[model samples]
Target: MVVKSEFEKLGLPTISVELGEVELEKEITENQKETLLKNLQDLGFDLLDDKKSKTIEKIKNLIVDLVHHKNSELKINLSDYLASNLNQDYNTLSNLFSEIENTTIEKYFISQKIEKVKELLIYNELSLSEIADLLNYSNVAHLSNQFKKITGFTPTSFKQSKDKTRIQIENL
Candidate 1:
């Protein structure tokens, strides 16, 4: 929405837009591109133009969609899901992600899932088993184990404690 408004402000047509990306219907001049990039950077966004940078951004976006938006049982393994969505080999994608982000893709995916779990827990709308099932965890024990591993507290303790701060999704 910001991108659309910003582009309209610049008299450009926003063809498509999503988190961390935007597509213009027509090519803009270099000066316009610089101005847009600067404006977006001021608003805490980046214009990912290079191939590798765009790939990395796509990976993050897909993971976010899977973790936060889908909210249902996964029909396939994450590796296959990513591979199919990206139309690339899983090993290649994993290597590129690790190289750029300094973390494994699996770890990134887990962190995203854990963040979503925290969100659901904070909302107080779902049981632990439901949360686990929604997030594709095999069982509540597995979910609790991972929650403890990443957050240093079980789900119940996390809910009951007075200080239940969660890491920002961007940080994860």
Candidate 2:
């Protein structure tokens, strides 16, 4: 009842609402759902449908998985891998991602990789060369160049800076 009332206040036409202890399920027709989503977007909120949001979430998970499990020795090409796994063409995914996120997927991927590099650097467990190898960079030089370009500091300098900060993965 409360949920339905709230939807009504938003000028939304609710079909049904189910309240659960841990989750809420709202059954809305496609047109009504799209209308509500458009309203949210007009209010400066992103309205990603289940399919689109799930695709983005899967991409995020894949990045994390590659970082944690693959350690940057990612064998599969990103476009081919994403397309095959998500059952969508890379171009479509890329376009949708850019339209929604306001950034290219490749940039997001690079940012995540740089974050992992920061993590490894903070641990002080691996040499720069080793870190490069672990992250699948061609060499320390390439990693240093990319790191400097992304963070505006050399890897060594970044490691030494007392206030080096990295954005959280989820926040990115």
Candidate 3:
């Protein structure tokens, strides 16, 4: 069984969850690694090299954790965090992410944040002020502004439209 903690060294901050054991004594072969890599590539991420793939995976994990976990308070300033955590200059990391992902890291970060806001809106647990605080926005107004900018509708409008259409996570 592969312990969840085994992924700790990958360096994306994650809460320890009680993942049940799933035993597989067989070691992953080179071909299996290639196949896994191919699957990830098919999902829109281009795996350039093992080192790049690892770095990209770390970024993906952080983004997903930020969006999917309500209790997760992600450091909103991703550039500074990425620079320090990945041990690279912000410019370098941003450039590589933009080059390979064909989108700026800031755009990706904002997209993830907006997705999270959508999820919160769906849950109807937190008020706009609370959601803004949770997401580390300057204020509810700021959150609404950004949310409206990325998505055509205002937060309130988005909430109203929820019954009509729910946005899917993968589409974001």
Candidate 4:
């Protein structure tokens, strides 16, 4: 929404907006493209003009949303969800993501999940069991195992650590 607002602020007559793509009422010139990029950058956003980069960003955004924003566990597998959402094949998407990120899509998704667990753990409002349930973990042990694997700290230890800071979403 804020990204779309930025486009409208530029008086370009925004047409549509999505995770990796944006459309304007008319085509843009080189200078206009530069200006738009600059504007988005100023707001900590980027205008991806390439398919690969855009697809990567789209994947990241979707994972972030699923892990952080969604209220329930996904009914479909991640591969199916991503392919259906992006209208791309799972194998192609997985290959591209792995090649560019040097990490599998599953690993990136797990990282996102770990980050969310860190946030929930730090808040202290929810019990570990509650947090596990909220994040759709099958069990606290499973969540704790994955959390320890990623962060080298169990959920309890993470909460106890002085440096409980989380990675920024853009960094992920």
Candidate 5:
């Protein structure tokens, strides 16, 4: 809504405005682009013009949505899901993501899942077993193992501890 309002204030017709994306009814002048860029920057957003950067951002957005918002297990492999969603080959996406992010897509996905686990743990609304089930882990053991590996603290330990550190989704 903020983005849409910004464009509307400038009298620009927009077809759609979504997280990390916007569709304009028509092209604007370079001056308009500059003004929009400045406005977005002031609002803590950056205009991504580079193809590779946009692809990376899309990958992050999809994974974040899946882990944070979706409530079911992924029916397909992550590679297949990403490829199908982005309309690109799996290998290309993987290679590009690794090159740009300095981490494999699998690692990033795991990190995101771990973050979600942290959030659920902090809420104290679900048991470890339930969390494992909710996150589509094979079992509690697997979730604990991955959580320990990434965070150095088991879920139970983290939950019981005074300090629980959760990385921001964008930082992850």
Candidate 6:
């Protein structure tokens, strides 16, 4: 809504606006682009102009959405899901993501999942088994192993400890 309002305030006709993307009725002028960029920056949003950067951001957004928003388990593999959504080959997407982000897509996805696990642990509303099931892990053991590998804290230990540390999704 903020993005849409910004465009409307600038007298730009937008066909649609979604997270990380916007479709305008027509091309925006250089001045309009500059104004939009400035406005978005003021709102803590960066306008990604490069195709590679945009694609990378899209990938990150999709993974974040999948882990944080969707309640159902992923029926297909991550690569297939990403390729189908982005209309690009998995290898190409993986290569581009790795080159730019200095991390594999799998690693990034795991990091997001770990962040979600941290959040769930902090909430203390679900058991480890429930969290594993909710996150589509094979079992509590698997979740515990991965959680320990990434965070150096077993889920139980993290939950029991005085300080519970969680990283921001964007920082991952």
TM-score of 6: 0.94
User: Number of the top candidate by lDDT?
Assistant: 6
For all candidates in order, the CA lDDT equals: 0.86, 0.76, 0.67, 0.86, 0.91, 0.92
Q: What TM-score, computed on C-alpha atoms, does each candidate reach?
A: 0.93, 0.70, 0.67, 0.90, 0.94, 0.94
- Mark the 10 consecutive residues where model 2 has the least summed lDDT: 17-26
Q: Which stretches of candidate 5 lie over 4 Å from their true place?
A: none
* Candidate 1 to truth, TM: 0.93
Off by over 4 Å in 4: 18-20
Tens digits of per-residue lDDT, candidate 1, 55-170, equal: 88888888888888876636468888888988999999999999999999889888998888888888999999999889889899999999999989999999888886877777
The C-alpha stretches of model 3 lying farther than 4 A from their native spots are: 1-49, 67-76, 162-172
Q: lDDT score of model 4? A: 0.86
Question: lDDT tens string, model 2, 1-172?
Answer: 6545546865665455542111224556777667756765665444444677767767776766776568744656878877887788999999988887899888888888899899999999999998888888888999999999999999999999998798887788
Report the Cα lDDT for residue 19, model 6.
82
- Assess the local accuracy of residue 62 in candidate 6 as a C-alpha lDDT between 0 and 100: 96
Q: lDDT (0-100) at residue 145 of candidate 3?
A: 91
Please list all clashing residue pairs in model 1, or write none if there are none.
none
> For residues 30-115, what per-residue lDDT tens digits would candidate 6 score against the true structure?
99899999999999888888999999999999999999998584545999989999999999999999999999999999999999
**Candidate 2 TM-score versus the reference:** 0.70
Q: How many residue pairs clash in model 4?
A: 0
Each prediction's total of clashing residue pairs, residues at least 3 apart in sequence or on different chains, is 0, 0, 0, 0, 0, 0
